[model samples]
Target chain A: MPRKSSRPTVATIARDLGISPATVSYALNDKPGVSAAMRARVLEHASAIGWTPHSGAQALRRGRSGNIGLVLVRDPEELSREPFYSAVTAGIEAATSAHGFELLIRFVRGGADDEVDVFRAWSHQRRVDGVVLLDLAKDDHRPPVLEALSLDFAVLGHYSGPEDFVKVTTAEPADAATVIDHLLERGYDGCLQLTGPFEYAHEGRRRELLARLCAERGIPHLHVPGTYTVDSGYRAFQAADTSLSARPAVVTSSDLIAVGALRAAAAQGVAIPRDLGLVSWDDSLIAEVTSPSITALSRRPFDMGRAAGDLLAQKIDGRIPGGSTIENSPAALIPRGSTARP
Target chain B: MPRKSSRPTVATIARDLGISPATVSYALNDKPGVSAAMRARVLEHASAIGWTPHSGAQALRRGRSGNIGLVLVRDPEELSREPFYSAVTAGIEAATSAHGFELLIRFVRGGADDEVDVFRAWSHQRRVDGVVLLDLAKDDHRPPVLEALSLDFAVLGHYSGPEDFVKVTTAEPADAATVIDHLLERGYDGCLQLTGPFEYAHEGRRRELLARLCAERGIPHLHVPGTYTVDSGYRAFQAADTSLSARPAVVTSSDLIAVGALRAAAAQGVAIPRDLGLVSWDDSLIAEVTSPSITALSRRPFDMGRAAGDLLAQKIDGRIPGGSTIENSPAALIPRGSTARP
Candidate 1:
């Protein structure tokens, strides 16, 4: 790992190659002045020396390309329905726009490795000053790669790994506990948790917390997998074995999932709050308009997004140190008709 | 407007200021070598002569920041709910990514003017090679401004009035006619069209088409406004006077609004199909998950997105001329329980 001060610069590369800094700059920037052969030689020497442009050269020192990079890695279909991202991205936008910075966003079709390549490519081209990381998975590959490249970044969401990056986490664990307590208080003997793909860091956190809490209270619970889409929620509901002695009150990861369950229940002639109770995460508009309006976790996504964006800005500006954890407004449970007592 | 060949170049600016091209490049790129006073004088001269760097200096010619710009100008809250953008953006991503281009996106809080400013800023900073314009309004302020700055761009969605730029339309007019024909065929005497704010070009087009069609057929039609959020949809549904004889069958621009109407009907004891019918646009997951799976216009937002993206890439690559229109797949009306004949 190279120390910050020791990172290769234009001057260093020029001296090593016995060339003027002007030639180095032209070759590095793909300017027309340098001959193709000389440019290749300069590039080869720079590569052998492990040279990468410092962020200061691209943004801080030169005031060039004031931008931040954010890459979204999700099925485009799923991304369209997930309100969480738009709100968070908006928050990031608000912060960046205020600072006169552009947010350079990209959507990668492939998984983590592809995402890593994107980060590398963007950084190499000096496209962004810093990046904001979202949905950090367990043993995520991003942080180490970003660290190696020495890119300023802030990780959004609860990632309890060893990466030193500015971090922000929504209160998913606490929110799950609140839902559990509410379900039990409503005299529900068993519970069903319908959640987004558990591979994501926060979903995993919620799953672990809820499962443990249910076990500790001696309450029977069933966990169902969903993709945070209406179709996935519908399928999860359709697939759940619902013939148990005590019907499980349902808790979902998103409003779309809950709505799917609600529609599935209607089709099955199961009555909400009579045969079952329901609670949804993210108090989005869908929760309000659902037939027996859903009880939901009011974890203001927009505000959380703003916090993440602001944190990234702070990290880039060097106002905050890496490994700093920002506690967002705690998630609050908003009780609605769907979770009404039997 | 300056023709392509007549556009200002580094050499042109250098000659105008009686300095070398290298000095001009250094002053413009904020590189050391040029004196601060000389740099200021060069910048002033360049600005006075409207000498913007050709895309070559930033991207096309030099391969600096292989990026494209896209600015979104919708309410953050509404953006999260509207699946249209995610699908379209994903399509754009697929194209840009395939061509090894990064997308620089930003969300602006204000309207068309704010969006115009974003385009100008991104262009002036050499942050993007070209831009992909979305949701262009009637008499949009963007194309003209973009033209004035000579920024390479492609407009997405329908903008009917007159700007000549690479264009794509979502077959919305034909889709509106299809929905109208379906409603009449299903024995619906009157129709209520629920839509996003009419100020948006597409929504306005839908509003005008439905109104004209209904008027011609002597069918009463009402256009209720919404912001594409579930709550707004709910309010629109509630505020819509349903007491008229031959109670209007609901046709919503988005599934969110249709779902909101469905829930409102359920709460009001207004049985769907028996008392009223419904149809939704976009054919999103919500349309399928609603109690009576909503009849919808399957426009394939993903494919539409891909088309927009491909078109932009072509324009940027100079494979297509400006003002070229790409016709999206014609909208297909998918019949579901919600619009069953009374």
Candidate 2:
């Protein structure tokens, strides 16, 4: 890079060299006609002022667009508030900067039919090198469509092996089991599980994972519908069997829900980790901001972003082996005040 | 438009009408003939049953790539987890579908210098008609670059001049002033402004608005320098002046910062509104979800994204008149208890 300058402008450099601004522009752009000495003076002054030519001008010759698209389900519009996704992007951007890509993030919101159409439209337009899919639904039609097209892409969530697709996801089922195993060991028996809408593929897996863990532990449990919303969690708490005989320890699918549960519990005169042992997936800043920190499946958003990027990079380079499964990031449960020894 | 389908798939239609799947496909796709009456019946039945040829097949023959690139500011090797960004995308998909544009979002994180090179690479490779930009820096170099290369693109934030860029921003400066005016009329006097990093144009304008508001009011004020990070907000509060006169009744800026301010205030035993009033931007779920609910200036992420789509659509249609800017949405103050009357 040219020698760093805090406040360098083209005019400043021109004034310093006693030349017209046009001459400075010509010299800086390297269009020539200035004496080599004048060019040297201009270069020295430009470096002193941080007046490098615009990146766009340089890009025309270097052959790159500083744009990358980050795709997600239920884009920012539909959400009342959710923190995990932003955490993931923060991580992705950290790595993107190291590699020099500008993330042009967007969302696709609607039912499954709309999702398929939206995915294909983005792919056909050649707006992004590869698209990243998250919150994959059961029997995701995306894999089939991608398979049938000349598109490059990757997934950031897991799916059953069928639609030969590239992906980066978490072993959410296993992680949920681990949290349950710990909860069971802590002597928390009856549970109310809060989760996102059932349409998501991972929701089923998370349910199954808990059921499997319950079966192995020989414990009978109750299942409740969840919308991964604070209101939902509050309602879940309201409907939960908090009776002394079958008091339920809550395990939420997300931190936001857990926070809501905590609030509801507090409203109901219940103490955290005492009346409820809450745990959520995708630990984000929310986990930290809550009154009682959340016990969650701590997945680094940056690491996850990096993982997703790696998959896309592979596809973009045509090195990705054609198959359904791409890559999986392991989800690790983190114990906080929400889940503790009573 | 095709007719709504009750039994749209080949298997379903074949089962419903006692026709073979191959015959159904041939007729649905308008392949060289069965009887014209039979073709009409097949087409009518198929339409009624929601049967249509897959997009890949159609795009393949037309030489259309069934995708739209979403360039993100992330390393090529990242897994995304940002919920707000996703919601914005959901909005984009909403528009994309209406126009038959598929969504292909990616993370391209790189240095300012090398990022555009990637965009150029994607363009040279014949991938997309245009791209969307987010997380813009002040004096963004990309719009000029996009303009110079005669490329199709739109940004989430405004550029300085229309002669060289395409942007859809919320006009944060004016919006900030409105909120500041609201606070001042309430005898809130000057606010302790907490905001995102100043490098962001939005933040820059926000700060300028706040400074100007304070200057115009002749009220002393101070801002805790920070990024759009909760941790930064927390730290800023820790170091914030606790003097009685200097303590602000209204704390302003990003919801994330307001959250931090809330936490810090709680830690310091400062009562909400009574001791300190907090105002925030982004009316995200965070605003409502925050205890006592943060007063916010709502910026419609969906409308902003759609406006950006419209700009990009215009560019793709070759109607771009020098990087046009659309202040598509204005931030409106949503008063909540966080900034309740003292």
Candidate 3:
């Protein structure tokens, strides 16, 4: 294999330009020691030769790595099945790139120790100037860890943890009302919510909000535990007693889960909207393409990601405004065939 | 906000240890001048002080940044809608993290020039020691650009373009034959393949292989354009001639496309697997959850990503074996209700 020519150093550039190394350094660093003509000559020649001052050297000089770290605490299968991570990552990338900073992403199995270890490595190595935390779990360990290390970070979801960090949260809890109202208006007297695992911070909030609203209307409601996967959704439906003549309308936490319920309904010969009503959260393309075009609340995941990215970038820039938490636009209900009038 | 104290320098450690700074430097660099006892003391003191040699300084001293760059050249919406990117990214992250390297991922809107610019930045800025490239296109500009810069890279798919980067390819073409055979076994004499945009390198290979296999069996075949999105799949099916009494079975490039076809079929009151047999590529969770559970070929995007990441890491480590191209495991067909017996 042919070896690449090593990056041209100041010495080499100075030699090529017949100038002293100190003179070249002064010109490059804008130290005002070199004449304008000589500085122009050195810079123009450096550009011609594709000589970029090494980032490592630049970072050492400025005492900043110019990087933002993000560690995902989910298994590969779970992360892949959901589009939320990818959408948020795209938004984070856009913001980081605009600032000439690179985002360093890692996927770690959901272990608090593993997460804390990652933070320690970044802190010791100075691998990032800041970090963006996602998927806030109950008893989240990251905020405290980051705080103890004196590292600046921004969490992507609301956290009631002890440490203070910029928080960017979606109006996920508020969307429950929108979903329930639509189901109620369609003449579904009672509804069942297949929620994600309770360990997740947002899932608890979503369930509580829905339960409160349902109680207010004196309607019966049940919360079935789900794992945010299609299989879980299917099992949740099967677990519901079919003997109940007044089976409640179904609402799922994710589009994949809703698709599963749709599959189970089709298998049972239950006609959608006639025999059963369904709604899926997170209006991805799958919701629109499914049979009966599953009703959904457009979470606008991309915009949420963008907002989180913007907030993290602002925190890094030390220009974040007064509040620590930001509530992005509320999700709006997009009633489709599944939630249409019977 | 309180500023973080600057990283401990050799001088600081030496002063605290009551030793000369030169002795501390020599001990840290493993030079002969430092005595064993003094070296141990300096090291322990440095560790106690939470001191780490700056990565930038170390990279400048050793001429390598412990990073790998990967840029996705796709539109944000397209990237988010497909599970392939997230799955692959997880795999890549797994491999990179295990090797103690960070993956710098960028999502670039499809522009050849922008991709080339990213490579150049990584090359000149010394941001990463090596890179992993994805989505090889016809007349790909990246291979040549990387080659000219003498950058070490690994392409995620086979590339016939001018350049000698490591190549990792999936047996996507072979999967085409599998889908075709499955269709033939189902008594379908003709099939229409809804493929992604022709410019993508894989699409042409997949289409040609399927078309050739169908021709050998004296079966009629059609290639309809698709964009790997649900909307495009729906549009492709809509654009097909329904007046033909015997419409061809449908094979789509992605699961989203197949879902779109399902939507179109439902709208026309056409029963699946009875009136129309359907198959989707890239078996994701959505495929199993959809009504009739669309039959699909498993692309194993996560494995593909891991392969690319491993190869790039190997190249960086100078341990890569002989050939530049690696053929990954061939995709396998998973039959389900969508392609059940008619």
Name the best candidate (by DockQ): 3
List model 2 lDDT by residue over A74-178, tens digit each.
534435256566656655555454454545554545555665664454443333344566778787777666555445556676577565566676777667777
- TM for chain B in all models? 0.79, 0.74, 0.91
lDDT of 3 by residue, B1-342 (tens): 334744577889987887788998898888997789888988888889878876787777776778888888778767887887888888888887778788898888867678888888887788887778776787777776676766778888756566456778878767778888898888666778888888878787778888898889887778888787778888999898643336357888888888888888888898888877899878987786677788998888898888888887887777874246779887888999888875
Q: Which model scores highest in TM-score?
A: 3
Q: How well is each residue in A183-301 modelled by candidate 3, as lDDT tens digits?
A: 77887767778877777777777778888888887777778877777778888888875433364588898887887788788778888888778988778767865777889988777
lDDT, candidate 2, equals 0.64
- Model 1: clashing residue pairs? B56-B61, B165-B323
Scored against the native two-chain complex, candidate 1 gets a DockQ of 0.14
- Cα error, residue B222 of model 2, in Å, equals 1.8
- The TM-score of chain B in candidate 1 is 0.79
The best-first sequence of candidates by DockQ reads 3, 1, 2
Q: In candidate 3, which residue pairs clash?
A: none
Model 3 stretches astray by more than 4 angstroms: A1-3, A6-9, A40-51, A161-164, A237-247, A260-276, A321-325, B5-16, B41-52, B162-164, B239-247, B264-272, B322-324
- For model 1, how does the per-residue alpha-carbon lDDT over A255-311 read when each residue is reduced to its tens digit? 888888988998899889888988997787567656677899988877777777788
